[model samples]
Structures are given as C-alpha cells and as structure tokens.
Target: MTAIPPLDPPARLLMGPGPISAYPSVLRAMSAPLVGQYDPFMTGAMSDTQELYRQVWATENDATLLVDGTSRAGIEAALVSLVRPGDRVLVPVFGRFGHLLAEIAERALAEVHRIEVEWGQVVPVSLIEEAILRVKPHVLALVQGDTSTTMNQPLDEVGAICERHGVLFYTDATASLGGNPFEADAWGVDAATAGLQKCLGGPSGSAPITLSDRAVEAIRSRKRIEAGIREEGDESASDFVRSNYFDLGMILDYWGPRRLNHHTEATSMLYAARECARVLLAEGRDAVIERHRLSGAAMLAGVEGLGLTVFGDVAHKMHNVVAVEIPDGVPGDAARGALLDDFGIEIGTSFGPLHGRVWRIGTMGYNARKDTVLTTLAALEAVLRRFGASVPAGGGVEAASEVYSGAAG
Candidate 1:
C-alpha cells in the first residue's frame, strides 16, 4: 500500500453557494469521540438534536429528526414514503433544485405533472394555485431556494394554496433554511428538509427533517418493518417502497421511543447537527437572518459597484447567495479558477441554463460576515482586473464598506 498525505488540505474561504465554511463549533462537535449507537449518551444526544432541529424548523411536530445523509436524502425519505406508485405529484420547476425534486418524484414512480416557469424567477402563486385546482395532486413538492438561479421561492401563499386544495406540501429547504426566513408550521408546510452545509454553518452529512401530523399520516400508510424482525402476520405496506435506506417510517421508529434497530446512527454527524442548531438558537435566528441580509446586500452592492450586472429577479433573491452575470470580456471559469488558486477563495459556478453565464457568490452561514463579504468582493475585483476586464481599483471594497456602515447605523 502506498503512503499518502495525512489529511492536510489548504484552508479556504468558502464564499460560494453551499458547503460554505463550516462553523468552528460544528467542526469541534464532529471531533468528539464516538459511542455505541444506542448508548445512553448517544440517545440523549439524538433526543437533544431532534428538539433543536424542531426549533430550527420552527415546528412542534414530534417527527422532527435527522436523516443520515445529505439534504437530498431527507427529501427522498419524505417523497418515497408519501408518494405511492400511482400517486399524483405536482412539481413546479423553476431552477435546478426544483427540477431535482420533480426527478426524484419521477423515480419514485409518481404520476408526475410539472408546471414550468423560466429560470431566474419563481413560479407565481396564481400558477401554483391553478395547477392545484387543475391536477389536484396528492403532493406538491417544491424547493424553497435554488442556488443555481439564486432565487427564493415565496412559499407562504403556495403553502396555503396546497392546504386549501387538500394537497400535501413539502419543500426542500437545503439552500435557504438558516439564513432565510422559513416558517414551517406557520406556513402550513407538511414536510420540510434541510442540510447542514448551507446556512446552518456545518459540513455536508446530516440532514434535518420535520414532518407535520398530516405528512406523518401519509407516510405511515406505507410503513413496513424489515422481514428479519417481522412477527408472523405483522402488517406491512400493500405496495412496499423501492428503497429501505430512504424509508422514513423505519427511520421514524429509530428516532422514536421504540428505538427500533435500523441503521446505526451517524453519531458524529448528529453531534455536528446539534451544535449547528445550538449556535444559531443561541445567537437568535432573527439576528442571524439580519446578519445574512446585510452581508448579502453588501456583496450585491460590491458586484454592481464593480460595473457587473446582477442576474435574476432582485426582488426574489435569497439572502445568502447572489447570481452575478459574467462580464463578456472575461472568461468565467478562468476567473473562478484564479480566485481559488491565487486567493484561496471559492465562488460557485452556475448550472443548467445559466451555466457559463453567471457566477454565484454566497454570503452564508459562518461566512455571512462583514469581513468575509468584503474579502470575497475585493478578491473578485482583483481577479477580474487581472483578466483584462475593466474594474475600479477600490470600488468594490468601498461600496461594501458603505453597506456595512449603513447597516451599523
């Protein structure tokens, strides 16, 4: 066997869309020694984590818990458990993540009906309302924020619409949860899922999920215990879900009082997830949202000050990330590479329709600070100027500083 390097990675300022710098406390939590999955301390940590995520999700549901994978894993668990083979699912695709929701539903063998809107914008409430009235889907699965297009879909009215139409409303909050305003209960969301990587200020691994009473009822209808532990005549789902790992019913039992043996819990990730919520709740969620709001505004101002156009509908932009149009004279990928290689800062590249046309700059989680925002803007200005693009020397920094000053005032 060859001897390789021992986990030495360059320290980077991750000012991009997601997986942005993990919170120091979160990383420390992940470093704690492991214990047996069902150890008293371990179960206590899991219970604490569940309670904390309930606060984070702003819900009182008993089903709020953590899934053992990324944000998408939580989404899959909710969908496969809710959508039967022939159930109707309506997905409104406006950006990459929304399309992802639709695709996952399709793979679940849902009778999928999609309502489309152009990228860089959100589907209007009226359109969603119309879709609900017309198709009358069993579930309406949507994404609250799509990093690819840098837009936050307004979920308040849509949730109400789904409720009025007797549809289960689920949202993937992977990209917007902590830094943005998300009212899972107030908005009548039946199920919501998020990851630690984005606004929660942690690495990608644990997924926080919450299920309303209605959603729990829907999932329980398809519940099935594993055959190994099954008693004779034990009731199982009529049409069993295709996946066991993404099975929410079994996961619920594992997290519930039953503590039924499913997969061994990811203890380190559970610790990290708990700490992330602890830090946010300690700082206060409203205060954290205000911080992200200020930082995002600063970055937007800095980019516009550098004579770059902002992409998408500014009115609907997320508080954590911005999509800036790549200047015609500069090579988008080359400039992004320069920023990373020379400055050790990461800015995201766009995807799908906006690919090669825009750079997604993020001010989120632990990085949503005045200094982080200013550093990213300054580095971006330098990279653009180096690439022979016309940019003012101190314009970006000055504008961002002004935003900070105004915010302080």
Candidate 2:
C-alpha cells in the first residue's frame, strides 16, 4: 500500500479575505486533551464558553451559545426558527452576503422583498425604511459588513426603523465581529451570528450567536420536542420546526441546564472559540478594533502608492479588509500565485461578479499588525512588478511605514 506524502505545511503569512490566521495561543489550546461530551468538567466548560462569547458580543442574551457547525449553520438556525412560512421577510442586497440572506429566507418560504443597490455601495437607510414601511415585514434581515464589496451597512438607524415597524431584526456579523465595532444590544439587534474563523482566530467548526428576548420568544412559540426526548407523562407537543439539526429551539434546550444530548459538542473547537474571545476581551474590544483599523488604513495607502485603486467608498469601508482593483496588464490569479510561492503569503480574490477584477487584503484578529502589513505590502509590490505592472520598488512598503510612524507620533 502506498503511503501519503508527509504533509509539510509551510509557514504562511495570512493576509487573506478570511481565515486570516489563528493566534498561536488558540492553536495551542486546540492541541489540549479532549474530554467526554457529558463530563461534569465539560458542562462547566460549556458555561464558560457561553460567558466568554457574551462578553465578546457585548450582549446579555441568556441564550448566547455556540452552534456545532460553521457560521452558515448558525445563520440557518436563526432564520429557520424566526421566519415561519408565509411571513413577510425584507432583505436588502448590497453584495454577496445580501444574496445569502435572500437565499436562506427563500428556503424558509418567506415572502421576501429586496431593495438592492450597486455592488460597491450600500443601500441608503431611507430606502430600507421605506421598504419596511411599505412591505411591513415580519422580520428584517441584513449583513452588517459584506466583505465581498468591502462595505459596511449603517445598522443603528435600521434597527430603530425595525422597532417602529414592529419587525424583528437579524444580522450576520461573521466577517466583522471582533475586528470591527459591533453592539448587538445597543443596535437593537434581535439575533446575530458570527464565525470563529475570521476575527476570532479559531477553527471554522463553531459558530457563536446571541439572541434577544424577542427572538427567544419567537423560537419558543415554534419549539418541538423530539420523540426520543419526550417523556411519557408529557401532555403537550411542539410546533414542528422546518429543519431538525439547524433548529435553534432544540439547541437552546441542549445548552440549557437540562443539558440534553444534541450533537457531540465539538470540544476542541469550543476551547479554541473560548480562547479567542478570551484573548480579544483581555486586550479590550476597542484596542483590538483600533489595531485592525490602523493596519487596514496602512494597507490601503500602501496599495494606492503601488498604483492600485481601492474599490468602494472609503468612508464606509470595513476596518479589517480592503478591496483593490487588479491593474489592466496584471493577471490577477498569477500575481496571487506568485505572492504565495515566493513570499509565503496568502491573500484573497473576489467572488461572483467581482472575481478577477479585484483582490482582497485582510488585516484581521491576530494578523492585524505593523509587521504583517509591512511584509504583505512589500511582497505585493514585488509580485505586481513580476506581472509587469511596473510598481516602483519599495513604494508600497514606504507608504505603509509612513502611515504607521505617523500614527505612532
């Protein structure tokens, strides 16, 4: 029998659109021993994980917990539980993630209404409010920051509009969570979900979510107790949910004091998620956000100095990621390959309509730093030159250094 070649993972500087780079501490935490799912220590660890996520999300939602899947799983659980069939759901599309919201809402059989804008721009709050007032949706779904377009939709005003219209508000913060400012409670967000893979610096298995009382009430109204879990003396049944594994109601019961068995909790992933939150909160949210903000600004300036134009409105751009146009003569994919092969760096390409037209550079979580920014800029400049884009040597690195030094003073 043939044996697999020994996998030698080269050290990579992750400056990509996502899965930026996990912190060494988080990686070390994952290497620790695993415990039984129902062990007493495991239950205690579960409680700690909930508390850690609550702090990171800045919410007191008692139902705050980790879903045993990727960020999309948490998204599905929230949407499926809150949006019943025939309910009016309003989705505003500004980029790829907006399409994601619409797709999920469609599967829930919602009467979905959309107010769309161009790819690089976010829809105005007035337009969203007008749509909500006209359609009077039962739930309003939005993505706080759509990384595809490098735009962040202003959410505070929309939240207020939802309150006035009696519509429940839900948002996906998967890409923006720790690297940007997010106030789940203050923004009046009813339900929000995020992934550990991005700014959290953890593996992709666990998704952290927080739900307000109203969201809980909505899920409670649609709860279903499974046959195996139902006691013989129980007289009442639940309103059957659309999907079993993605059911938020059943998940809540499992995480609650009753501690019923659901999926075997991804123990290592949970530990990593907990540690990610621990590391971030230990440094304070504002400081961590500021780190990403500064690094991202430096990257934008550096890219511009290299004769590249950034995509989207700079004023409304996300703090951790930048999208830059691929120059006319440069082959985008080839340049990316050069960066990885020659510099041991990983950056990202755009998706769908924007693919090959732009490249996305990220400064997120543990990877948001001066050294990473400087290294990436230097490498990008060299790679673009290799592709005959004619970038001046040291131009990108020089501009980035200027930004960092100026900020220091």
Candidate 3:
C-alpha cells in the first residue's frame, strides 16, 4: 500500500466569491490548544466571542451565538426555529442565495411565496412592500448580499416594511456582514446570520447569528428540550423544531449563561471566529467597511479599465465581489484555469443565467486589499492577452491606482 503524504496545499490568492484567504491572526488563533467544552477558559472564550459578534452585527441581542455549521446552517436554523409548518414566508429573489432562503423555508414546511426580479436586478422595496401587503407573510427571508449576481439588496427600507406588516424579518448576511453596513437593531432586523468566510476573514465552519426578542419569542415557542435532557415539568411544543442540529433555540442555550450541552463545540472554529471579530473590531467596523469599499472600488475600476463590461446594476453591487462580462472570443473556464495555473490566482465562474457569460471576481475577507486588487487585475490582463482578447497594457493597474490615490487626495 502507498503511504499517504503530509497535508500540504498550493498557495493561491483566493479572489473568488467566498472562502477567501483567512486572516493570519485568525489562522494562528485556530492553532491554539483546545480545552474542554465547559472549562472556564473555554466558556470564557465562548462568552467573549458572543460579545464580539454582537458588535459585528451591531446588535445588543443576548441571543447572539455561534451555530456549529456553515452559513447555510445559520440560514436553516433561523428559518426552522422561527417558522412553523404552514406559516407564510415571503422571500424576495434577487439571485441564487435568495432562492436558497426560499428553499430552506420550504424544507421547514413553510408556505413559501416568492417575488423575483431579473437576475442582475434587485427586488425594489416598493415591490416587496406590495408583496408583503398582498401575501402577508409571517416571515420575510432575504439575502443581504448575493455573490452570484454581485448584488447587495438594499435592506434598510425593507425592514420597516416588514415591521409595518408585523413580519419576522430575517436576513442571511453570509456574504456581506463584516464588509457591509449592517445595523441589525437600527435596521429593525428580527434575526440575522453570517459566516466567517466572507468579510469576517476566517475559514468557513462556524456561523454567527443574532435574534431580536421578537424572533427569540418565536423560536422559544417551538423549543423542544431533547428527551435525554428533559427535566420534570419541562414541556415540548406541538410544533417543535424538526432538526436537532440546526435548532437555534437549543444552540442558544449552549452559548448562553446556562451552558447547556448540545454537542461538542468546534473549539478551533470558535477561536477562528473569535479572532476574526477581534481583528474587525480592532480596526473598527466602519473603518474595515471603508477598506472593503475602497478595495471593491479599485477592483471594479480595474476591470472596467481592462475594457470589460460589468454585469448587474453598479449602484446595487456588493462591496466584496464583481461580475465582469466574459470577452466574446475567450473561453471563460480556460482563462480562469490559466490564471490559476500560471499566476496561482483564483477568480470564480458564474452560475445559472451567467454560467458562461461572466467571471466573478471577489475582493473579500483577507483578500480585500489594494495589493490583491492590483495583482488580480494585472494577472487578468495577461490571461486575457494570452487568450487572444484585446486588453490595454497597464490599464487595469493604472485605473486601480487612481482610485487609491484619489482616496488619499
């Protein structure tokens, strides 16, 4: 039998939509020695992480905690916990992730209703209000940022619309939380969830979530203390949350002062998530958001300077990713491969209506920097030239430099 080799991976600049390079500090944090789940230090670390994420989400909800899974897990937990079977859930579909929210709601047995706009467009708040008035959904599940179309759906107004309709507002901020402006409480968000992989600058695993009192009330109404832990007089609801692992109510207990055992916590990921928030808070939230905005602006300018057309509404595009139209003669996949093989840089391919038509370039997490933007643009220029596409010499870098310098000015 052949012996397995040591785990080693190639170094690539991950300028794709998600799972971008983790922060150096976050990586170091993950390597720290693990302790027992209920150990004092472990519990302290968990408490600290919860507090940190509260700032990250800009909310004071005591229920802010980590879900022991990916961003999708956070989405499902929020949906299943708050939505009972036969409850109306209205999802505004702007891109792929929006559909994901609707699908998750469906799995939770929600009577799902969808209002969609074209792929590159956002669902207007007025349209959403109209839908809310008509459908009168109990929950409004929306995606804050959909990486698929590089659109950041404006959420400020929608929250009020939901509030007016007494809808439990939940947003999946997996792709946009740290880098975008998300005022969970001020925006009247009843529930919100995010992952570390995007703007939080960590590897994907743990999902940070927050719940308003209204959302907590909704979730607690369906809480089922597991049979093993059921105490005398403890009662289970008729509409108990179906999934044990994705039950936010139980997960909240595990993170809360009670420290009730649910599952063995992923200590490394907890450390990673902690450090990710520490790094963000140290830089200050608004300052970090500005950095992402500047980096994203540079990347967008760079691509446009390369004579590439951007896909979607420029005004509505997220500050972390951009979709550029693929040149007519160049093969999208091959060019992406060349960028990877030759330059060790990874941009992303499109999905659905954009499969072969556009390339998704991301400036997110640790990769949201001036240097990464400039390097990606340079590499993309060379790849385009090699692929027989006409690209201006030094155009991408020069344009990006202008944005940086303009900011300085």
RMSD of 2: 2.2
Assess every candidate by TM-score: 0.97, 0.96, 0.97
Residues 220-283 of candidate 2 have per-residue lDDT tens digits of 8874667557545656543346788888888998999999777788889888888999999899
Give the Cα error of residue 329 in candidate 3, in Å.
0.7
Error of 1 at 32 (Å): 0.4
Least accurate 10 contiguous residues by lDDT in model 3? 229-238
- Write down the lDDT of every candidate, Cα atoms only: 0.91, 0.89, 0.92
Global Cα lDDT for candidate 1 = 0.91
* Model 3 lDDT, full chain set: 0.92
- Mind giving the per-residue lDDT tens digits that candidate 3 earns over 180-295? 89999989999999999999999999999999999999988874767656545656554778788898888888888888888999999999999999999999999999999999
- What's the number of clashes in each of the models? 0, 0, 0
Model 2 residue 192 lDDT?
95
* Candidate 3, residue 289: how far the Cα is off, in Å: 0.3
Q: What ranges in model 1 sit over 4 Å off? A: 228-238
**Alpha-carbon shift of residue 236 in model 3 (angstroms):** 10
lDDT of 1 at 177: 95
